[model samples]
Target chain A: MLSALPEAISILLSLEGILVLMLGTSLGIVLGAMPGIGSTVAVAIVLPFTLTMSQAPAVMLLLAVYAGSVYGGSIAAILINTPGTPQSAATCLDGYPMAKRGQAGLALGWATVASVCGGLVSAVVLIFAAPQLAAFALEFGPIETFALILLGMTCIVSVSTGSLIKGLMAGMLGIFLSTVGGDPILGEMRFTFGNWQLFAGFNLLAVVIGVFALSEVFIRASAPISNVSELVTFSGIELPRWSMWRGRLRNLGKSVLIGNVIGVLPGTGAATAAFISYAEGRRSSPNRAGFGDGEPDGIVSSEAANNAVTGGALVPTMALGIPGDAITAVMLATLTLHGITPGPNLVQENPTLIAAIFAGFFIINLLLLPLGMALARVAAPVLRIREGFMMSAIVILCALGIYFVRGNPFDLLVMGCAGFIGFLLRRQGFPMAPLVIGMVLGPTLELTLRQGLILTDGNFLAFFTDSPIAFVLAIAALLALMIPIVRNFRTSKKD
Target chain B: MPPTITKLKQESVIVQLLLLITAIALYLSTFKQGFTDAEAAQSPMFFPRIILMLWIVLNIIGLIQSVRHSNVTNPIASWWRILLVIAVTCVYVNLIGSEGFFLPSMVFALICLPLFGIRNGVLIVLFAVAVPGVLVLLFNHMLGMPLPTSRFTHYF
Candidate 1:
């Protein structure tokens, strides 16, 4: 893996690579700065375009968007008092206060610098940690992999907001949906019901766009458009002075550490990391007294932690082939579409591609400082666009993107149904992340479980009894599922 | 709370139950489709059957819990507006195939902008033409990927 860096750097240095990194990052920031378009939706919006790209560039484009959007969210949080993504919600606590106090430029500067540092550090962590983890995961048999995936799915569903039972149901429904195309082992159709389109099952991209992007449009449409107004005026980002780091270096380090740790954990995401880091900063920072009242430390804590999560979330997905959330799931799906299977052997098989991804991710984070400053001016006018036109535009892009992916109109139908259903379910407080994760992980989970069962001669107990790794993972899966429920029950009892 | 909020609240439970029933029916269909020996670990039905059964059970549990402790809140948007958007979007999807991408999208925008609260006629028309045109240019013209087009004009 270390040896692949030269080739990877060469790929990143190419004209096409440079163009993709710059443009993709710029698009991500613009979309992420938009009030309603979050990172997941931003990635989904660009997903269609990547289909025409090659293996490395396609993945690189998405990675650029993912990293850029996470940072771009802080712009909205500081200037407009709106967190573009939920992860940036923590940024609002200090970002908005700073903006209101006439430090909007400085606030954005702190966010940009902190976000870049955190992202760079996380990318370094990814480069170093992913290889080791993948090397370790090489020992994972089908049973152990199955156990890890179970843990991954349950952890995500459990960590998700809203009703646990509903999250589980959504997860199950997603897994069931993945089963529709064909039975992996028997080669028999399970749920297609003789429809030829059902042979390939549901298009994951269509469902992703529908549930994440189109449904978001539907949600916005359903809501009253009262905020179709001008956002806070912002010229561009102002870089914080070098000497300003004075007493805040500790907070920055701690927040980045918190972000990386939370990011590596399955199901826990950037939003959780940011909030946790913010609270930690409030407790431990030297500037604790000024925590939320336009404190630069507050912005640093939230922005650094959330941006750091971009790399942290990729750890499990790259090493174990299990996506932690919807965004990563979409990435894994893209890799699969590019003829690259993402699992433990992924690094061993395609060292150059993996190294290029890691290197490109680093470049994307570095681009944040310069590109963000340049793009902030452009985003202000965009933010002024009316909600009606914006929503209509998203719908059009989603429809066109989905249609062109396979040039199949049926995908549009699937997208429509998924959007409507997703809207209704979201209204009822179901999180869509678990559903997407479930669908992405479902096929692998099934394949591994059946293969493990066959290896054990149909004795399910042997799956755990034979492999210690599988045993540990299975126990972790159980604990992940039960701990949340137990905590909720205890809280309710107190109430 | 308004009666309409209460009604949407009731509809949530209905959605939950409807989801539960649909899941069970699907599971029953799975049994009929010859993955019935789900007890055999190697059978194709083994994994999906587990997921479906678990889903059904979870749905029932959620339904009971929801009915017992409802925390429904009214969203600012009206249900009628949501339904209207869905209706228009469905029409747009059908029209893309029949009338091609450009015309149906223009029509969709012209109708939807006002429905979405755009009051100005000129702004509506301007947007109705420009938005779809830009999208077509991005996908069809710039990328050299052809979008569905009517015989009258190929570029759009």
Candidate 2:
């Protein structure tokens, strides 16, 4: 990773690179500031346009959107008192109150500064950490990779923030959906049933856009349309005086650290990081007394942690081919669409491209400060558009995105069906994240498991007995799933 | 959460039961699709069958848990509106194949505005026209994506 920096820097110094950084960041901030669109939907919506781009720029575009959107969420949190993204829910507690007190500009200022610092630091962490992890991962064989995927699969239990059983069911459904195509190793079709389209399976992008984006439109369209529009007056951001930073530096640093650590852990994400950092700031900050009532420390805690997660989340996705969330899964899918298969060897094989991504991510975060201030005005008016128009636009864009991938109108039907199914499942308390992640992980899980079984002559237990790394990972996966269930059982028993 | 916990449990049960039946059907279909029941590692049916069996078990478990836990998340305002949106969306999809991208999307937006409670006629026409127009320009013209073209190719 270090060796590629010179070449990476040269790539980023090119015209296309600079334009991608600027446009992607600016577009990301605007989209993120939109109230209804979360980071996943935002990324999914922008995904198809990236297909026309080169490999490095395509990945960089999504990264910019992911980072910029996380920061952009804080704007809505402070100004509208409604979080633009789930990760910014913690920000609303103090951000809204601060805005209500006529310091909307200052509140946004604190959030912007904290977001930049967090994202910048996490980028550094990714630059140092992912390559080391990938290096260690080079030791893995099929069995160890299988065990690691099993560990990754334990994340379903964690991400199933709804009913555990329902989450597991959704995850199962996702795996099933992923298997709809032809079987890889056997050269025999599994579930295609002689349908030629099913040979390629459900397009991942179509499924992704359908479930995440279109389902959202359906859900929103089903709900009551509020007549009231209440947004705080945000003329511009006012940077906090240098003296205001005197007491908040520790809290900011701690929040960024919390974000980076939690982000690297599969299944845990920005929302978790934000809440944890906010709680920590409330506990240990010098300004703890003002913690809930428009405190700068509160905004710093939530905004910084969530933005830092933008970089932290990429570590596993890039180095190990394990996506911590749906957005990163989309990233991996983009890499695949561009004919670059993602795995531990991704960095080793595509050093210059990976370097470009890493360097572009850093630049995107740095661009956030100026873009956040500039785009807020542009986004404010756009936010006032009626939900009806917005929903229709989303459906059209999603349809177009699916069709353009292969000019296959059949994928449009696939997308529509997925969206409808997603809406139905969501209504039944099924979380969508697990299903998407399950689909993303399903192929690798099956491939590695089959290879491992072949090596062990169909003895499943030998997966644990043979490789110590596999053994440890298998044990970790067991504990990860079991501990949660045990705790829930104990809690219910106490209740 | 719905208006009542009872409603939530009922909906959850329906979903679980439906999935359970689907899993059973899918497991049977795996063999019908020509996957031989060859021993563990050798067959194409190996992983999917295991997954289907687990899916069946999980759905049954979920069915029981839904009735017992008595809570579901995400409240809906009206099922009628939901059905209406779904119906319009279906029409929109069919129309896209027959009519082309622009007209169907415009009609979708125009109808959708009223359904979502937007009443201003001018705003309706504006959004209806603008949505598809911008998409065609951005996706088709600019990005080289092939959106379906209608009789009025310029608009499409």
Candidate 3:
């Protein structure tokens, strides 16, 4: 790694490579700021261009986009209620409220700083700790994976401020909807209702776009259109004061660590990291009550963890030949398309290439600070735009983005239907975060639980005794479940 | 007569009841999903069944909570606006499938802008035309993804 560092720096310093990184980062921020147009779509759009370019510059471009887009997602989540990427969903819990309170600049600043910190740390981890982290993540099997997802589910309580029961209900509903397509294990068609489109089940992207973006449109439609001044007032990005950052270093560090560790695990994405980190921040912060109500710690925890996922995900992809998440899967495809084989021997075979990629990723994160601030300054004026024109533009973007997901018109209808369902659910005090979490993690939980049972020959006790990892995870899940109960009991006693 | 419940509470009650009914319907929908073997711990229906049961319980709890509490105040938007959004979206979707995106989306924005309270005709027309056209250029030409197009617009 030390020997390859010079070559890496040389390549990144090249004009073409630097230009690629700049272009990818800027375009990524643009796409990621648009509701429903996420990192996956952004990468896919640029994928064909990579086919014609050289390997070093090509990979750098995609990596820059990957890192930049994850950070860019928090912008929309802060400015509007809609999260640009699903991973930034937790950011919206605090971000939009801050924007509404005329602190959009401050919230954007917190997100920017948190994103840089997380991305930089993850890049360092990728260079030094890749193999060790990959080995650890590889030990997570069916039982351990299930327990981890259950641990994530405990976050529902944190997200649901007013009522826990309603949150769980919505989560359960989301999990059920996930089972609408063909059965994962049996390959049996279960809930298609004879529609061929239903055979594939509801697309997660479509559902997310509908519930968050389109439903927002319906909710906004009912209110009188106000000027952008009434929406979000901002001048320039406001970095937090030194006194404000006094004790929050621990929170930021912990969230970045959580994101990196979870990112190493295959299939768990940035959204999960954002949520788990937010919950942890809530648990550890002195201003815990201010959470879900525009707390700065909330923005830090979510943004830091979400951006950290970009590098953490690469750890498994490069070290183990496993795609850590969907975005990484697309990155893996790009690698294979460029005739580069990724696996354990990849480092030894292409040492300089790997080093260049890492160096480029670090540079991209550094660039994000200046680029993001500039973007925010430019975007602030968008608040001055007419409500009707702005809403209309957003509607077109949402419709077009969702259409591009699968190219099926049915997805459009699904978006409309989901918007209605989401609107009604919101009216009844049901939180959307839990529902999204359930949809995201439910299948993995069920698939692993059943697979573990099969492996154990239906003996549930084996889950606890089979491996220390599984045993520890199960205990953690149990504690997570019990914490709420214990808190409720304590509250009752105080009452 | 006893004091009438506020419209917001009434709406909440109706929504909760509708949820209960939907949960029941979801439960009934599972009848056609034949069960798997006994060795699988539970059949494919097991997950959905458990979920629907939870949905039912929660809806009932929500109903009780609604009656006992009168704190459902300050809904974000009014009822007609919500209906108008749903209707416009429905038409826009069907229009895209049958008539293509470019024209239908223009109509969607034109109609939706007014509903959203935009009264400037020039601004509305410019916006109605510009958004779809720019999106078409970007997604179709630059990204190489095909947008829905009918016979008339296919040449472009």
DockQ of each: 0.70, 0.70, 0.54
- Fraction of native Cα contacts kept in each candidate? 0.73, 0.80, 0.71
Error of 3 at A311 (Å): 7.8
Candidate 3 chain B has its poorest 10 consecutive residues by lDDT at B1-10
Between prediction 2 and prediction 3, which has the larger TM-score? 2
What stretches of model 1 exceed 4 Å from their correct place? B1-5, B34-39, B151-155
lDDT, model 1, position A40: 91
lDDT, candidate 2, A1-495, per-residue tens? 778889888878889888888888887787787787889999999888788788888888889888988888887788887788999999999999999999999999999999999999999988888888888898899999998888877888888886787778888888888888778787777677678988888888888888889889888876678553687787888888999999889999999999999989877889999999999999999999998899999999999999888888889888888778767777777777788867688888999988988888889989998888788778767667666766777888887677676777778888888889988887777888878878888988999999999899999999999889999989999998998899889988999
Which residues of candidate 3, in runs, are more than 4 Å off?
A1-134, A230-361, A488-495, B1-5, B35-42, B71-73, B151-153
- Could you list the CA RMSD of all candidates, in the order they appear? 1.8, 1.9, 7.7
Clash pairs (backbone) in predicted model 1: none
List, residue by residue over A260-309, the lDDT tens digit for candidate 1: 99888877888889999999999999999998798999999999999999
* TM agreement with the true structure for every prediction: 0.97, 0.96, 0.70
User: What lDDT score belongs to each candidate, Candidate 1 first?
Assistant: 0.86, 0.84, 0.77
Candidate 3 lDDT, A287-397, residue by residue in tens: 678999999999999999999988988986787555556577567657865777555556777878888988888899999998888877664444346656656665677
lDDT of 1 at B154: 68
